[model samples]
Target: MPARPPAATRRTAVGAALLGLVAVGGCDLDDLDPRSDPAPGSGEPSEPPADADADLVETVVTALSTALAATSAVPPRDRAALRPLARLHRRHLAELGADEPVEGGVASMTAAQVRSREERLQRRLADWSVQAESGELARVLASMSAAVAQQLALPAPRPRGAGGGS
Candidate 1:
């Protein structure tokens, strides 16, 4: 009769098996971005993926559009600092094949209001990232979320010579 392995050895084997399963499972990426080039010789399918998830795509697009609008509404003092961030949102929209978002509402907002809007947008994007249906879409959403969070984390740029004595 074969001898049973010790408990510690059995636990180690089970742990290793679970870890291997995780490693393999992580590789299942249907990250096929519709915008990406065709695989090998497959020139092009009749139509692009558009999105495996129409709802998710629309949600992301709308969220970004709203956020972009907020940036536009920021008081002039803050717009220069926020220009790169606005551009980032536009790039994300472009990646999703969305046109530049229409600007509506709020010609200008107080600094505090702009900050609040950005914070809300960051949270919404983060939530949508994990909920996304496609792995590539998930990554894109997460990237946008991270970008927003990073922008928020940064100290607002100081006006030249404004901080010398303060």
Candidate 2:
């Protein structure tokens, strides 16, 4: 009969096997390194991601900027309440730390383009407000504004490709 391995050798072999298993499973080791960009001619279909946060920010900024400018005046209390919201928007965008400024375009964008996009949204919101019945106009604006406000208030940008959290 073959001689059994000594207890110490048996333990060492088991330890080595376990170590190898862990190394194989660990995230630190990769089939493809994440640090590298996707290969050219990979022929994988990948759409550029939507800039939902930036879009919402631009919409709110444009709509609020235009509406505030267009009105003869807003009540002092309403204006005061709006101040923090505006600040929040700026702070959130700053936190996003996007190298590019919030140009309306996903790729390169300029301030003028951003402003134009905002203006368009502002007009749409205004028309919707006017057409709404039973104070629905105010409700719609308030709801959209609130949604943007909530998104702005988040502590960090959502991860690059999916889902959200504070």
Candidate 3:
């Protein structure tokens, strides 16, 4: 592995990255989405986001994959509610320039399982985002983490077209 940059250099890189992101007037996935014309992961290897610390990205990927694995444990009745979160994790993986993860075997997802996996993913994303060498990468990771938190805080989504009594 290449020697990590000195602290001063890393800090400079982080600052420059943030400045560049600010110059563009955006910081979320909208500006960072790479899935335009040719498609996001068109079998072509993508360059890691600006000075993204390889180790940090790897950690995020692991967390994401874990969350995806948890998806398989979702009970049949709950699959509809959890499906979107799984899809989002897949998108997050793609945004990180990572390959698609294999799905886990089917099993019943208990409330404890959902809470444990999702919260762990959120924790890892938040913690690693802070240590990211690239401000751009950090921002993206933080956003992903926030999305997880938002989803977990909300009531489980009802199946589409399932309405309550008038």
Best by lDDT: 1
Judging by lDDT, tell me the better candidate of 2 and 3.
3
Worst 10 residues of 2 by lDDT: 26-35
Per-residue alpha-carbon lDDT of model 1 for 1-166, expressed as tens digits? 9998767654455455445544543423345455564555686655454656678878889888887887778666677877777887888788777888897676678656776788888788778868887766666666666667666666778754577895
Question: Local error of candidate 3 at 31, Å?
Answer: 12
Tell me the deviation in Å of residue 9 in model 1: 39
The local distance difference test score of model 2 is 0.39
Estimate, for each residue in 9-49, the C-alpha lDDT of model 3 and write its tens digit.
54455455546544552444443433333436667665544
| Pairs that collide, model 1 | none
TM-score of each: 0.63, 0.23, 0.61
lDDT of 3 at 17: 51
Alpha carbon lDDT at 4, candidate 3: 84
Error of 1 at 123 (Å): 1.5
